[model samples]
Target: MHGQPPNILFILIDDLGAVDLASFGSTFYATPNLDRLAERGLVFTDAYASCPVCSPTRGSLLTGRYPARIGLTDWIDFGGRIQPARGKLVDVPYIRELPRTEVTSASLLRGRGYSTWHVGKWHLGFEETYPEQHGFNVNIGGGYLGAPGPGGYFSPFDIPNLPPGSPGQYLPEVLTDEAINLIRNRGDNPFFLNMCFYLVHTPIEAPADRVAKWEARVRELGLDRRTALVEGEFFPMEHKRHLRVTRRILQSDPVYAAMVESMDENVGRLLDTLEEEGIADDTLVVFTSDNGGLSTSESSPTCNNPYAEGKGWMYEGGTRVPMIAAWPGRIPAGSRTAEPVCSIDLFPTWLAQAGIPVPDRLLIDGEDLSPVLFEGAALERDALFWHYPHYGNQGGTPGSSIRSGDWKLIEFYEDHRLELYNLAEDIGEVHNLAEEEPEHTRALHQRLKEWRGSVAARIPTPNPNWQE
Candidate 1:
């Protein structure tokens, strides 16, 4: 087994923002476990999900390629084609599954002799389209990432006929238990267990006991438990009655808070399981989220702002997320790296750490980040790129962008508009420097143009019924 590669415990959360963590100056909550993870490994302040939403972000993370390269630009609609809202985007339905032929981290790691396993949200798809086809032994919960995890959260068995024992198991708990079991029964060779979670996302439900605890907290604060995801401001989609039912859950609803706290508690369980198995020192654990928080849907009407809109936006509030990597005796404890990194980097980085060479023929868009994590090396790429042409429910502008050094350029598609922000000076992207610095804007633009041309992204087809 090529001298024992360090086991990887990749815990990817769903839509937890970077600013939400204490290490990133989040005053609202204290994530001691996340903070501790950052202390043990490298915490990249500039890390981002490739896309601002789930499916696309995950696609890039797995393939190390731009989402456009593979016809997966929008979230795949679980049910069918989106009928479209008049005057909006073409009524293109989401792709229910990731296309075949895409290479993944599992395929790469499995080749290197690491026992690979995936437990948790398999939003990518099911059966042939699931994690197994991509190269990992699978134990998928909330099998389809299309729905907000488990309708009520406590124990959601969305799958029509999921066995008896499954109904009583919460998705997060199910995943955590499976991961712990894997660690307990590890073979001599190091493993790579991708523990992707469907946490704190939606279907905001929790165990009755935990919810009761949350209810008591709300009562102490003199608030009602019928307004889930409502802290202040408004619920734009609460007009729908079915959604209104789920909305009754309080922002202070002990249930929702307990759901989040329970995810954390399970994280603690997985950590303890690692130490208990006597492999804690050699394991490389990463804690991160797929994208920014979700805003609203059939089951939820929440938004992660103060920074901006929730997910599906081309802004910092949507793209920025917490990224903590921990490896004992290798990575520094209580350390943080400000260099920007993306989930796609996992493919190449894991390959490098395992002493496996990434194939030059792979057309990989991400660079190996092991050097930076273990040796405090600078970000390998001169820039990172993002392209999302479709409009999502969230009030976000569709755009494409490139980040080279401190120069960042974002081009909006609605009105052929462009906005440039020197992230070094303004991380929130408030000022429009495109008019002021045409030279910098143009340079980034040309680079993007050339990149798009190379990727050969799908161009809009001629409308057969065009009146013009």
Candidate 2:
């Protein structure tokens, strides 16, 4: 290990699924770079995001706390894409911006002399609560806007803090260029690069060449004839009741595949830059997503199969995400663990790695996964919880969920419906054992309720406008 604190490279993909990469069982999406990364790092099989949506998970990752605890439970849509939509239950009021008082990992690391830089997708707040205010030394392409602005992932990109590149320039590549520049120019001090890539998200437009390439590949593989998406139940939210849930069954969407490939290529670029800068061994590299892939709505891009519904539902496919950590000589190469860890764990894990003492006053819900990451030891935790009290943009109702050991339980707020699944047995979550195992259900439900109480999680109340 280096005598100095290792540089931290956190690569957060916007809407990547648990199985989006070739390394993580995606036979369709090409991700050679991430596959190579998986070979050099520990692949967390049961890793999870704190929420099904974007901003909540992002906040949880930064603060080492659950979204409910932080009171930032939904995606912050400053672009007016998502407004107040009526559902069975009215969405609870949430903190639109990440509170100034909260101690983010960026702030903590900056205090300890690490040069922190955040690039892309800072939807946690508006201008006042941006990456600069939250402790990043440099903020590029980050703003209140969740997805790419008016330019839509291409140059003439209207992203804040980042200058537009040449016309037709891809946003991911541009963001990566900024990240690589930061690393190359970094001085003697160890740096923290919160490299959040806004790829594989909405407005899924990729270079025509890349899209054409995937399109050709799909035909070559005989996947072009297969069904890609299927219509499911009507949207739970009243505003979108006219539309049914479109579930992507196959990962054959050429455009989305192109976007995924583009993201992978940029990841390769960042990894290559680390090697070129002679800092490969002196850095801790983490690759994960803010939330699961967008499969159940918004064009139904990628399929997260063998794991049930994706991105807004409280299913395995929604919250489960791919997490790979590589720190040469520190974390074992080619290691794999099924230990359940959440986005919240990243904060404490990074702090532990940097030898920073977490203050006692901070009520961090995340546990340090150093032992599991470094020594292949079991993660000592009772349960991981998620509280998403708003109707999902992708057909999910208001709910709170808890995962303890191999068992998972979800409580839907609209009708107070309870769902229990033994993930080990039913990875697809097709079978709900809520009634089959009454004792287990009661125990988990009670624990979930207790956790909500502890976190003071807000619950959605009945909507008065419902005609049903």
Which candidate achieves the best lDDT against the true structure?
2
- Candidate 2 residue lDDT tens string, 1-468: 237788999999999999999989999998999999999989999999999999999998899999999999999866555655568788888888899899999999999899999999889888889999988999998888888978898888888898978988889888988898889899988899999988878999999998889889999999989888899988878779999999999999999999998999999999999999888999999999988889989899999998888898888888999999998888889999999999999999888877898889999999998888888999769899999888889998889999999999999988899999999999999899999999999999999999999999998888888877
TM-score of each: 0.86, 0.98
Model 2, which residues run further than 4 Å from truth? Answer: 79-81
Quantify all predictions' global Cα lDDT against the true fold: 0.69, 0.90
lDDT of 1: 0.69
What's the lDDT for residue 150 in model 2? 80
Model 1: colliding residue pairs: 39-333, 39-334, 214-254, 226-248, 227-248, 227-249, 227-250, 228-249, 228-250
